[model samples]
Target chain A: MKYAYYPGCSLESSAKEYDLSIRACCQYAGVDLIEVPDWICCGASSAHATSHLLSIALPAKTLVQTEKMGLHQIIAPCIACLTRLKVADMEMEEHGDLKKDVETVLESTYKGSVRVRNILDVFLNDVGLEKIEKTVTTPLTGLKVACYYGCLLTRPPHIAQFDDVENPHSMDDLMRAIGAETVDWSFKTDCCGVSMSLAETDVALELTNKVLEGARDAGADCVAVACPLCQSNLDLRQKAIGNKFGVFYDMPILYFSQLMGLAFGATTTDVGLEKVIVNPFPVLGAI
Target chain B: MRNKLEEAKNIMKVAVKEDTTAFAKEIQRKCGQDVLTCYQCRKCTMGCPMAFRMETKVNELMRAIQLGLRDEVLSADTMWWCVSCETCATRCPQGIEIVEVMDVLRETAIKEDYYIPVESIEAFHKVFLRSVEAYGRLYEMGFAMDLNLMLKDPLKDADLGPVMMAKGKLKLRPHKVKDLKSVKKLFENVRKLEESRV
Candidate 1:
């Protein structure tokens, strides 16, 4: 089970713990993650938001490199990265001039043959639930988690083509495999205003406040997320979000990969759990 | 791009040509999404999570495009506030790629000018792409600092620097891609292509 890995920018910095935990899970899952040699930034939320030419051309370079690496599929753990790469792949196949222009920009042809998959999709579909169930050495039986699937995880249907876009159960199913109770929540595919979090602080904070309030109302002990942006927005900004709203809900925004590591008998430090703003150790400790 | 984006920037600069559908036609030509086909179902606006913060809702903006309200549609803060949550796109009954339309609006805004009262995000993207062009990957600390300076709010997110560095997430130096020169050429080529299109 070897695959190319494009960590993207966030995973490399700010979301370092997410990168660590994901690599740790893949190691135990017996999956080999070959870092695509000199992978370029996929020009995520920025490129697509700014320039169509750059958006397609940027990810085209990454896809070309993945093919050169001889991997038919690549794993991009970040939801934004997954969307950008997948969208670029779709554009490469559907648009003739765009593809040609992209190739001309890079001085390379984009075959558009490479498939982009998120780690969760690989674990649930490729690795199967039974294997995951048996791999859980320390079952998190009592810990309740609200699985946060930010927008674009599986949507604009033709592109992501991953789990059910509206009520994504893929993360819940994975959480169940690790013996954790997945809480049903409304903000499953809600927008956390990730891009706005930096630009318009109040707008982003107020929007994130809704998700935080939703989870807090759902009676979950903590939140489990697949995307780094959600984790940081919900966790990293929890303090400011609370300060602005005059209500503080200390729900830990954990990486689904980190929770998987804990289920596999990994310690807090092993998955870099100490790095998150809202600590999950106390919540996990309660169990 | 000019009609929709430029109208909002400055009425004097935007010339509403004879064809009202010219803006719609330009959008379709640039990107495949069709705004003229929308019949005001409002499904896109209904599912939009950011509607609370948007001045013009998705459906309203779609109608604005259809009516050739170039300046009104282009100057809308709605596109900038969009998180690209795909909910609107996924739920649109007309099969209109609403998110793509927002992306198109943003790019058009850039082409016209970054004077849509959301220059901060524009600054971020510009600096972000510059970082990628320089190193093939985001130079987080450097980019954030540069973005702050560009936005003229240098003290913004100042506390996050040391906190991130403490967690070993913020790197003092950038992880430059091995083939940095080739990566830069891609950006240059794209810019040349963009400027030459019109």
Candidate 2:
């Protein structure tokens, strides 16, 4: 199966490994990810913070482009972008005046012909767990991973409408399919502070620490994240948190795609596992 | 924590405006203007990573806002402590932009000149605005140094220091955008547009 793809800004830069893992998984899954032409930033965490219209317009531009291309479903790997796009879709569908107002600004009408799905949705729903199970060339035996949902992916159930808002099973099911253990953790849907990680390090640390500590305490060897921002904050900020609190819990935060890749017999380096700020060496050795 | 809570309450009492109708209206769309959906679930409080770091309950702050207890909402340490991860927003069944609501509360508090440890974050915003205002884009290095100096915490920048040092990325150099004059013009135009719209 093929679908249009929107790899938001973070995929292009901070989480390049996520982009790599997406390509690798798609290769194995037999899904063609056709990039949406002339896509702009999804007005990510900051744009919506600054203005309401820009947030809608930014994602609407891509939605309009998707409609023009005759594609019905688009896969956004980034959780923040997925949320923004989905929220925009909900705003337009729920609020008629907003749809008209946004349409006027773009000077083009959108027909809501597109559905935004996160990568987790694509693998679990579209591709089916049986397909994923078939591709498990190397089952990740005895690897414990904490599935971090990171708030945006399963919120305002009416908008995201992907999984159980409180207790999501899409990631867990996918992880189980790949032969990895998923932790029953409370902070799965907790926030990693996104842009605030950059502006407020202390705040970011506190948030990151809670998630890390929760996962660590829950007996997870590593944490699997679907969002790049969550990955960055958890993986990259660990050093600072270690330095800040004198607690060094070296948990390897893996992009969910990386886990899928490992299950499919791809090597760590092949999935860009070495690029993570927190060293995956300990877990790698354990495996 | 009790002393801090009393301090937070005292501070919020003076910080939030006595009249909250307009303030509430502006944020009503965010929380769906439904102030009654909160059944004291405390889901937000339990899951907030920074909740313990802060002195007050996020649920308490929302309840205070819903009750039109403007002084408490404004004065409480909750808004300032909010890291805006949207954990609360995501969990809130009433569909509150709890983070955005916190922003409005903070911005309102700032406008009212409520006392806060504003220097560090304020500097980041100032540097952000400066970059946007000057170059029509953000310059990471320049903004980085400006924020550090503003906070008077040179040690705060240690996180990126090592990476930049190893990669030879942290140069004490300022880079200007191409067509530098046009960037300045762009900023001016943007400012003018924002003012006119307001």
Model 1 lDDT vs. the true structure? 0.86
Off by over 4 Å in 1: B1-18
Best by lDDT: 1
List runs of model 2 lying over 4 Å from the truth. A285-287, B1-23, B29-31, B36-47, B53-57, B63-80, B89-100, B103-198
In every candidate, what fraction of the native interface contacts is reproduced? 0.75, 0.14
Residue B86 lDDT, candidate 1, scale 0-100: 86
lDDT tens digits by residue: candidate 1, B44-157 = 888887888778888888888987889888898889878888888898888888888888999998788746866777777888888888888989889888988998899998
Worst-scoring 10-residue span by lDDT in model 2 chain A: A45-54
Reference-based TM-score of each model: 0.94, 0.79
**lDDT by residue for model 2 over B11-99, one digit each (tens)?**
99986746655546656754354555567788888867677766778888777776677666666677665656666777676666677
